[model samples]
Target: MTGPAAIRAALPHRYPMLLVDRILTVSADEIRSVKAVTLNEPWYARLGEEPSKADFAYPDFLLLESWTQTAGLLATRSEEEPADGRTMLFGSMRDVEFHRRVFPGDVLEHHVRLQRAVNDTLVFEGSSRIGDEPVLTIGTVTVAFRPREQLDPEHAGRNSAPLTGSQRGEKS
Candidate 1:
């Protein structure tokens, strides 16, 4: 099992946002990880006494975030530690589906696979499950690593220009 220390070394996320708990397995093209959902999570802080079942249901977005973080770790594994002032950014998501309501006490196991890679951009496919039950399925998720300045227009300069179509492996 890969611990939080290794995750911290590869990812820039921190507490309250670092959703992945530990990696189960990793390979050149895929990774498996898990996140345990519990009432103690910050997302439940706003709930009052006698909260409804819906209140205990983990948010779909957080599930996706956790799964994507796993994908990011596998995608950048071969790189020489993440570069400074650079961050991984989601480019696109397609055909994603949430099949079940995940609640507290559920352990989400994510299986992510590297679909394709071209230069600094990567495409991934995966799914999340609670034991034998499927919870989330991702068709494709695209991500790219870019300088922080490129994401902030006010800070963007000649060196921070956005990638062009061809640069992103797209047809003109």
Candidate 2:
């Protein structure tokens, strides 16, 4: 079992973006994780005053992202730590489906299986549920190990010092 701290160490995500709340089980072939949804989520705030019915529903894209992040952890568990200045990124996803709406009180249970791993790319198949009700399904998902420098040209090379928000042209 992996708690929030361990999950934080294993994943680069944080705060409102860090979707997975806990990892119940993980092995070479499969993984199970959880995400506790609540009204405190940033998306809920984005709905503004007197939100509509659609605003109460969790966004489908974020549901997919949460599942993909869970798969990413499973995919990288067996591999050596990524080399300096490198990170794993979502490559692609296919046949993703949403079976039902997920609400603020729902606890998303994610189940992911290792479909295959070839070189730097890993493939997975997974689904999510809230209790006995199915919420999402993914036929196949792939993630790639990539160099930060290549992914962001502004980052310079492997040995380059990290840049601050202002240096990157963002408000501090």
Candidate 3:
């Protein structure tokens, strides 16, 4: 079981944004991770007293983000380049579907598989589950690693045109 310190070292996400809790297992092509959800999360703070059960349900987008973060960790673990001064940019997500609503106290277990990799672009497919029941499934997700300087508007010359997804190392 890998702890938060290792996860933190591999991912750039910080508090309130770092969604993955711990890594259960990781290999060259696959990774299994988990995230424990709780009522104390910031997403639930906005609700009023005695909010409906539906109101307490975790946001779907956040669930996806957590799963993606797990995938990022796998990419970092397998890649040779250091993550320093580089940012992982989400290029695109396709065919994502939610099967069940997740609430506080549910532990989300994610299993992700590396589908393809070329240069700095990575493609992944995965699913999330709570216990034995499936919660979410991702068909394909593409992410790219880019030097931080390339993302800075100030550094990208004022007159220079913005780089397309291909130029940014994203697979079209």
lDDT of 1 by residue, 16-123 (tens): 999999999998888999999988999999999889888889999999999999998897784444656777888799999999999999999999998988877889
Clashes of each: 0, 0, 0
Question: lDDT tens string, model 3, 23-63?
Answer: 99999999999999999999988999779989989999899
Candidate 1 clash pair list: none
Q: What is the lDDT of residue 82 in candidate 2?
A: 53
- TM value for model 2: 0.84
Which of the predicted structures, 1 or 3, would earn the higher lDDT when compared with the native?
A: 3
TM-score of 1: 0.84
lDDT of 2 by residue, 1-172 (tens): 8998988888889987999999999998899999988989988877877887777999998898799889877967856665358778787789988999888999999999988878878888989999988899899988888887865766775666676687678985
**RMSD for each model, in Å, please?**
5.1, 5.4, 4.5
| lDDT by candidate, in order shown | 0.88, 0.85, 0.92
List where candidate 2 sits over 4 angstroms from the true fold.
Answer: 80-84, 153-172
The numbered model that scores best in TM-score is 3
Q: Rank the candidates by TM-score, best first.
A: 3, 1, 2
Best candidate per lDDT, number? 3
